[model samples]
Target: MVDELGARFATAGHEIALVGGPVRDILLGRGSKDLDFATSARPEVVERLLAGWANHVWDIGKAFGTIGCRKGEWVLEITTYRSESYDPTSRKPEVSYGDSLEGDLSRRDFAMNAMAVLLPSHQFVDPYGGMEDVANRVIRTPGSPEDSFSDDPLRMMRAARFAAQLDFTPDPAVVAAMEAMADRITIVSAERVRDELIKLVISPQPRKGLDLLVATGLADHVLPELPALQLELDEHHRHKDVYEHSLTVLEQAIDLEPRLGVELPDFVTRFAALIHDIGKPKTRKFEDGGKVTFHHHDVVGAKLAKKRMKALRFSNEQIDQVGKLVELHLRFHGYGTGEWTDSAVRRYVRDAGDLLSRLHVLTRADSTTRNKRKAEALRSAYDDLEERIARLQEQEELDSIRPDLDGNQIME
Candidate 1:
């Protein structure tokens, strides 16, 4: 579908380039199949040109000058050069068409993405020194940082995501702009915020991206729970601030296995790590000797996670998975002791069910601490518990511990 559309656009005498991440990734020697095209042709003309070659065409964002073409398993997006201005109260843009590719590139969110390549000839066009920015490992917005983020607050999240994904530092001015306009993020849709966050958390340097979010004050607007988790206790008896600990867990989770062949994307696990300890603030208590503990924080955190997921308009399945992971995140660490009873393992397996492995990953991440011995001990215990669960399953004890009673089965 990409080839067909590319050919059609090329033949139409319109300058089209397979642009954005696809070209950027190719230059960076990374794999990317998502194709995007930038052209001087108007959106309507591009639509008409693609209609002949593409059997499946949809104007998914025609107002923003985007049209999608699909042929079999491949899909390509063709967009015209355009510029936009945003209302102060909404992320939705008021658009204006641009005569030159430079105008369009100038309006893009990041310098790396602002670069383009000409189709057929494969010549690169970089007006904003995006290639240089990519080479320098820096993320900079096209034109002014304030104008870029003010036009779309979601760009702040995108900055963090690109930083995480590309292992680049955002320009200091851009970071300051993000901090100043953090409250403007509320104008963006929850779904867009969630999408960017998912990408950020899934990236290799997820903790870096999250730290940036907190540092820039963006989390206070989009994820209030995170900043609230930063509340301090009176003494050393308290654990680390929940917000800092959450980032630590996220880093540790990625460091532990680094790879899980689960069907869900890496971002989901990252998101779970970010919110796993959310209940701690609400559950905090001061005992004798200034000892601070969060009793039943997992249970409370699960409920808070669900609310956060809902606020972000996450899918029902995603919300449930994140919530479940938050609720049982602590179960694996203590499983090697008396908690390793056959019945306990069965219940653990049953509670976690399809998410058992992911929960283990989360638990491993959650055990982050300064004490090397404790960390090693937790890892050892978790290993033993996993082996014990396997042995129990082999004995068929797990299979027989169904929740369905004999009377209920007979009634059915």
Candidate 2:
């Protein structure tokens, strides 16, 4: 498809190149379904050029000098070479068409993403040593990190996202810039920050990237609760590091998705695990014997998760799902020796509603216990709960648990 597009562009007297992440991905020996290109053609001409050739085209990105279209199974975006400027207070950039591909690439977020592949001739362009940065597995700005991030602070999150997605470390200069300019992230739209965070969370080994964010002080701007956990004390010191424990929970929750069920987005269980104990920081109390108590942290954490997610522009449905998981995460700990009555199991299942499987994963993941005997006992108890819930589900639709009789029957 790209080859055909390249041929068409060449015939039309427009020089084009595969630009940005796709070109970088190719250099890394990775194939991607999404392709992006830089072309000398204006948006109007590009739209006109693709008018009949493309299977379908959309002008959603027209204002940004982008033309997005899809043909068969191939999805592609072609943007007129752009040079964009931004105001300190505004999240949106002022876009202007650029005449040179090198100038366009230099304005991109990272050096690796600044490389391009000239079409037809297939010549690689690396005006800023992007290929070398790729070879060293490090992220650096084509220009100064300050300039790159100031152009768009959301690029800071992208830096972390790429680190997570590619397992590459940021250059020391970039890290210093990130730490110094962390507050600049506030100027970015919440939606953009949320999107990059979601990418980081869903990336393989997100912890690596998250750790970098925390270390570089970026998490303090986007996810204050995450960094706040590091300062709080856990009771009994069961988990000396709340931040690491939360990450472990996220990992475990991901692993248990198939076991719990995959009907929901994988992010459901993962998000639950990530924020289940977020309340601990707020509820930490010094007990009588130098002991710490996070009484009702689950409930508090649920509220915190909702507030934080809302601030980050999460949807109502996702907010509800994650908030409920945080709230109910501690309920299973109350079950001693599988002693909960059938009524309790019914309430548990009913309260969880469609999130029962999610609750199961969150509860299990919360147990980062070291004592083998205690861990085994907790597992056995949870297993028993599952068995009882299954039995009750067989006898009475536990999911829709209600009074034994309907209103009509009661009236009769």
Candidate 3:
């Protein structure tokens, strides 16, 4: 595909290069179906060239110098070499076509993504030392960190997302710039920030990216609840750190996904685990003997999670799923040593409904206690619960259970 497209463009006296993420992924030996290219040809010319060659073509981003097409199994986005600048208060960027691939690459978010492969000729271009940065496993902007982020403050979040996606560390200067300019993220639309956050949360190494966000104060604007997990230290009480425990739970939930039949990159489960205890800080109370308790934190957390997700413009389905998970994450604790009767088990299954499988994983992952005896006890109790649920499922068809009559039936 690359050779054919490049040959066609070259023959037409236009320049084309496989640019940005596709180029970066190629160097890292990662396979990607999405191909991004930069061309010296204008959008119209690019569209003209792609005619009939592409199985399908679209111009949703034509104004931004981007034309998308698909050929065979490859999804391609061919964009004219462009430079974009954002107004201080606007969420959108004003894009202008550039004349050179180097100039286009220079404006990218990271040096690692700034490399390109000049198509047809197959020449590798690394004017910004992107190859070295990729080899070193570090992230740096093509230009100054400040300039790169100012062009599109969402790039700040992208830095974190890439860190999570690639398992690469940002350079100190990048981190410092993020810390200095964290407030700039507020100007970017909530939808963009939320999308970046979802990518980070679903990545293989979410904790690394999340930690950077918290460390750099980016979370302060985008997700205040995450940093607020660091509740005021009560030296005397000395309970497990809620913030650290949440991260551990997220990792454990991800680890349990395959075993429990939840799909990989289950953002609902992962996000629920991360925010399940967000209400702890809000509900913290000291008893007479200095024992700390977060009474009704599950219920409180459910509301908080829904509210925050709503603000981020998440879909109604996503909001409801995560909210319900947060609310039920603590329900298993009541079944001490499998003491629940058949009725109790039925209610448990009924309450969980479609979320039962995920609930199982979330409840199991929530047991992050270091105490071997307690952890074993929780696991055994859950094992018993699952076994009972399975038996009941066989005997009673608990999965399809419902009220005998609906509201309309009752009315009739």
Candidate 4:
């Protein structure tokens, strides 16, 4: 299928090459199913050629010169050389086609993604030393980082995402550019920002991406709640800063559950991890004795998470799951310390409902602290709680715990 597509593009007097993530992954010796091809040919030409051989062809982004062609289970994305210019307010770009491969490479978001390979010959083209950056596990822009990022502030998030995904660091210049242009991210749509955030949180090392967000000042613009979480009391409480603690929680979540299968449940867990402590800022209080307390922080955090999710236009199911997770995050800790009563456990089971396992994963992630003994003890308690819940479930004790208990039956 690849060969046939290659031949079709080749016969049209255009140089077609596998590019972007597919090429990057292939060079890194990783398996990639999404195939993307860069072509010197125009979008229309590419579409016409693919239409003859492929069963399905779509102009997913024809205005920006992209065409999607599918053959059976295999899908290929083809795009002509293009450059984009953005208005100050919206992330949607004003795109124009370029005539050469250099133009396309120059316009890419990162050096690692800029690298392309000739399809038939399988020869890599690294115009901006993308190959060297990829080999060294660095993420740099193709040209001036300032110009590249200014053209699209969302690239700042993408840079962090690549760092997390590839376990690389952004070039110093790129990092500086990201910091300088952090506020500009507000101009981008919340949906675009959310998508990038999701990708970063799901990466192998989510902390790397999140740290970059905090460091680059993007967090202040994208998620101002984080900075609010950083406020500290004098010396009363030794709890870590809320932002740092959240990152720790995210790292722990990724560690505890490395692979969350592609589904709504997985995304909910990740989103919950990111916003689990969101209420701390709103609930913070300093007592007369200098004791710092975040009373009802979980409830406040859940409210904040709902607002943020709504701003991002998350699906209703996703919003509900994340909000529920944030609200009940502190429940497991309470269960660990207090009585694991049947009523209490039943309440948890009812609240969690279909999301019990996901909630458990979130609880495990939330146990990150400097106190190793405390953490371990909590883990053991959690395991016991799980066992108890399982036994209760097996005995059908929870079956009748539903809210629709029969007042009519009682009357009868």
Best candidate, TM-score: 3
Each prediction's TM-score against the native? 0.87, 0.92, 0.94, 0.89
Worst 10 residues of 4 by lDDT: 257-266
Quote the lDDT for 412 in model 3.
Answer: 94
lDDT of each: 0.82, 0.87, 0.90, 0.82
Candidate 2: residue 362 lDDT (0-100): 85
Give one digit per residue, the lDDT tens place, for model 3 in 1-412.
8899999999999999998888889889998768899999999999999996999989958889999998988889999998777677775878889999988988888999999999799999999899999899999998889877877889999999999999999999999999999999988999999999999999999999999999999999999999999876677847768889999999999998886565578999899999999889989988887789999999999999999999999999999999999999988878876578899999989888898988998999998688999998888889989999999988776546766888899889
List, residue by residue over 1-412, the lDDT tens digit for candidate 1.
4445556777887777777888778768888878788887888998888777776888978888898888677788888888777687788878877777777778888888888877666677888888888888898987889988888889999998888887889999999999999988998999999989888877778777877888999988888898888877576745567777888887777765544676444656778888898998899888888888889999999999999889999999999999999999877756656556788888998999888778878887887678999989887887777787788777786567756578768789
Q: What residue runs in model 2 are displaced by over 4 Å at the alpha carbon? A: 232-239, 263-265, 397-412
- For candidate 3, give the lDDT of residue 89: 79
Top candidate on lDDT is 3
User: Model 4: what TM-score?
Assistant: 0.89
Positional deviation of residue 100's Cα in model 3 after best superposition, in angstroms: 1.1
* After superposition, candidate 1 runs with Cα above 4 Å error: 1-11, 51-58, 70-74, 231-238, 256-260, 332-340, 397-412
Which regions of candidate 3 deviate over 4 angstroms? 260-262, 398-412
